[model samples]
Target chain A: MRRVIKNLISALVALMFVNAAHAAGELHIFNWGDYTNPDLIAKFEQMYDVKVTITDYDSNETALSKVRPGGHGFDIAVPTSSHIPIWIEEGLLMQTNPNEMPNFVHVAEQWRNPDWEPGRNYSVPWTWGSTGISVNTAMYGGEINTSELFFSPPDELHGRINIVPEMNDVMNMAIMYEGGQPCTTDKEVLMRVRDTVMAAKENWKSIDYGTKEKLVSGDVAVSMNWNGYSKRAREENPDIAFGYPKQGYPLWMDNVAVLADAKNVENAKLFQNFLMDPENAAMISAFAQYANGIAGSEAYMPADLASAPEIAIPAELQSAGVFVPPCPPEAQQLYTAIWTEVQK
Target chain B: MAETENTSSVLAAQSHQVAIEASRRNKIRNFRLLSMPALIVLTIGAAGPLLIMLVYSFLKAAPYGGVVWEPSIDGWFGVFLKKDIFDGTISIATAHLSILWRSVNLSIQSTLLALILGFPTAYFIATRSVQTRNLWLFLITIPFWTNLLIRTFAIMQVIRDQGIINNFLIGWGLIESPIEMLYTDFAIMLGMTYVYLPLMVLPLYASIEKLDFRLVEAAYDLYATRLRVLWRIIIPLVRPGIVAGSILVFVPSLGAYVTPRVLGGGKHLMLGNLIELQFGQGRNWPLGAALSIFLLCVVMGALLIYVRVAQRGTTEHV
Candidate 1:
């Protein structure tokens, strides 16, 4: 009986060790809805022997508001470029310093040290895309590569245009249309911005987020659309094509960062480094049809995708894209009022 | 001896009746005692969120979509008035009024539409035999089993340009081009009518089923024509049902966000969507809270009016 008891104790201890080995850790990721690539998650989970769970938020405000007060139990989050400074100022994110990670060299030269995250202290680029106009070639074949397609649609496309419900994108484009920089505080520019959009609203059929479905189904012949969604829509309907708006467009990037109070700090840091790898970053781009800032990720992407017009902006038009960062509280209030009046 | 026994039995019967009445009173007291927890839960559950909303509405707006601790009436002011962005002149918030008007307009329109459509349906069901009546009701409730979002999407599928209706029209060469019907005010109204039709029908059926049709025959015997009998007899009898159905359809329509969002094309703002904007991209939580409370007040006002009319209708029934 004594010998049997000894054996049972040893077996129990062995079982506990096995459980510990199997249970590496768990990571809870809060990201934009329908944005995360499942393959990348699966690969990361297998690589680190950790469980990965993702929750989604539809907008930057939602992401910020939820994470602001803490206790969200999220290890990582992907927030848009415009809201990054706000998140940093709120101290909701931990400085993971991706520049110190092994995979930091894979980040493209231009994106290696952005003004928002100098030396990549806090975040890594998850995906980047531009908001531009997408037109159905069969509808009106005229100059589709311009903001005029959205703000001053031709007679043929009148009442057939759809503007996406992104307030910043619409307001920024309108600002640019009046020969002003984005997030400009000048009252005159802001006034023209309001007037331009308000007048444009008449020609537009809808201001909606589901422009991809609307475009593919031919519900709207023209739409102010995001590049990735336009790419997906074009895949469904070849006649639907995306064009970089010449009168400036919004260049936005969603960055992955660790939460300040994350329990799995090591795992979160590992995931941040994992996203910088070319193959993994390429997986993200493939799923969302967005462009990743990883150097040589294109080698892993499909030939059509690597050279897709929606992915590759032309030379002259490349300079037209601007990253519209967060406006100050006062400027934001002004913009909000203008937005309300426009939609109202 | 027989006289004595009969008197004793009568006294015993009267005592037994008294005992039964006493026990019934005791049971009522026990029921009230047992219901305390549920009453407490209801009061807390329903009123707690409302209290929070009331408090939030009076607070100052935070920069990035929350309220500051400081109290201010800016939210309420924003609801009825606007400080112009350009000239900095304060004026009546016609934009807000327009949204409010849209919500009210849509609710009223949908209620009437639901009545016209549901009245006939409920009547048809009520006129059927007992076996068929339940089957027809079962059919009316079949739509409810599916989720509301799914139903709205199904409507979208049926009406989109490349969807079944357009496809069918084009296939048969009925018209040269497909009609754009998916993203109009008509579409919003149609979706609402489809969604809340059952709410209208059920109440109308409950009252119509209890309707005394003998009055109709009596009216006819008094030389009342078909239209006159319908106006004087059937309509008057179903007044309670009409009010109930209208309230049921109208209240939800006023708070409707999904149907209008899906079908209204975002060209116009409804009250529910406007409130949502304040909480979301508009980044003004105080405004959202104020808007929510305002909606609650509207709903309460509606309910109070309904209660008064319903009381009168019930009294008239007796």
Candidate 2:
């Protein structure tokens, strides 16, 4: 028995060393859940001989909290446009050297030189989309043109409507519905928007962060969702429609950044560059259904998904939508305070 | 001179014995030092995360994605400044409170129901052969081996539209349309009750099994009615079990997120969900931490009040 136990202990020690060695080449990526297919990671492993470890955060704030402790565990993370400046100013992200990444040239023109990350310094754009209403017309018996479906849903639709759990989306929707610019940091405008949302909260059933599953489950009639998730949800149940309200939608982007203390720096950079490649980017976009930042990837996308009028990029409509910039701490504080108070 | 030498030798031996006793006490102290790892694990696993959250609440969100180290009242102001919004019908404060109240109310109701159902069942088993009692106890523990989320999701699928219950209703031509059974408050309450019922039963069963039946029979022989005998003899003995069961049911349900998310639909938002939104899409850590502290304060305050009330009630009967 003693000899057997000694053998078992040696085997366990050997196994631990094997796992530690195997984990060395692996890059741990933290991003939105279900944002990419597992097959993409397998394909990347086959091509690059680098293992990929993927973990997902349901929201930007959740991802930020995990990466805040000086990049202890995660090598690559996807954060929103609003968080880029904050992450850069804190030195949490490693500066992206354009020379090192040749595939950076394929990024969409609109993503380059954005006010948030000037000169393409710290982050690389992965995917971009808009926040709009995803409604089941069959349930509503008509079309939804405004954010009212979420803000002031009909009595029958009460408890059936799903709103974004975020204050930015909620407050922005209120501002847009009230004929105010969605991105305005004007105090009076913000207060009015807050009050409007507060009034709407009484009848608000549930605030949902992830939508595709909820919309398909028939728990919600109308939901505020990203264009990609809405499209995905509609594919599962054909009766759903994703539409931007008559008021402009909130345009947001997820950017991939290498952490300052990344263990697998080479693998992390390689992964970012790999994602930038048009063919690989197309495979991701086609499966994820979210629009990618790679310029030439559109050519590689399927004709049905690419040319579909709903998913097509209209230059005029794109310009009208607001790109979220990192606001002052005061504005964020005010937004947070109002959101909590409203929920209370 | 002889007496002095004898006295000194005896004193020396006595002092040596005291030294030996002190050494034994020191060894016990060393044992305590070895057990310190458990306390460190508890502090790191629970209090450490909460303390980090508290610290982050005071900091400002930097223009880039990270938080600025500068201390500010901005986070507190953010939560407090929305008083008008909180006062409004759609306010999160009201919603959070209502959800919490509903969860507490449901948990309490279910606990009472479990006590009623489990007491006699446990008593009968306890009175039976020891082998039968062991089998019954084992059956009660079988469900706990599975994950909570999977079990809750299973319950959801059973009652959901196109689920077994809905299909049965539709097949029987009981209704033209699938009943909106998933998102309503009723479904949330039902799920909470089901999840917590077994928890209440186990504790109650333990208490009921230890009960002395002779005391109840003596009370009945004294011409006490069934209700009076139950209240005076049986209930008083099982009071501790009831309190233990209630705490078990109440604490877990207080912060429950999964059941409401899956079974409650979007209709019923709980305090857990509100706190989640604050950290999640809300991007408001200070407010989320504040809400969490608020919940902790409420739980602590209620516990104090309950202990006092329960003591008084028990003392008065005595």
The numbered model that scores best in DockQ is 1
Kindly list the per-residue Cα lDDT of model 2 for residues A1-344, writing each as its tens digit.
99999999999999998667665467888888878767778888877777688887876676766787763588988888877777777677887664348888888787778788887766777777788888887787765656777666678787677786667776776777777775566667777777678777766556655577778877678888888878888888887887777666788888889988788888888888888888888888787787887888888887767665346656655654677676565566557556655654
Q: Which stretches of candidate 1 lie over 4 Å from their true place?
A: A1-22, B1-28, B167-175, B306-318
Q: Write candidate 2's Cα lDDT for B22-61 as tens digits.
A: 9989989888888789889989998998887778778875
In model 1, what is the error at residue A245, expressed in angstroms?
1.5
Per-residue alpha-carbon lDDT of model 1 for B204-313, expressed as tens digits? 99999999989888998999999998877898888889988999999999999999888888888788888888888788888889999999888889789877976786
Highest lDDT scorer: 1
* Real A-B contacts recovered, model 2: 0.30
Model 2 residue A256 CA deviation in Å: 2.0
lDDT of each: 0.89, 0.73
Can you tell me which runs of candidate 2 are displaced by over 4 Å?
Answer: A1-24, A152-159, A191-205, A314-316, B1-37, B43-128, B158-181, B184-186, B261-269, B281-284, B316-318
Q: Worst 10-residue stretch by lDDT in candidate 2 chain B?
A: B84-93
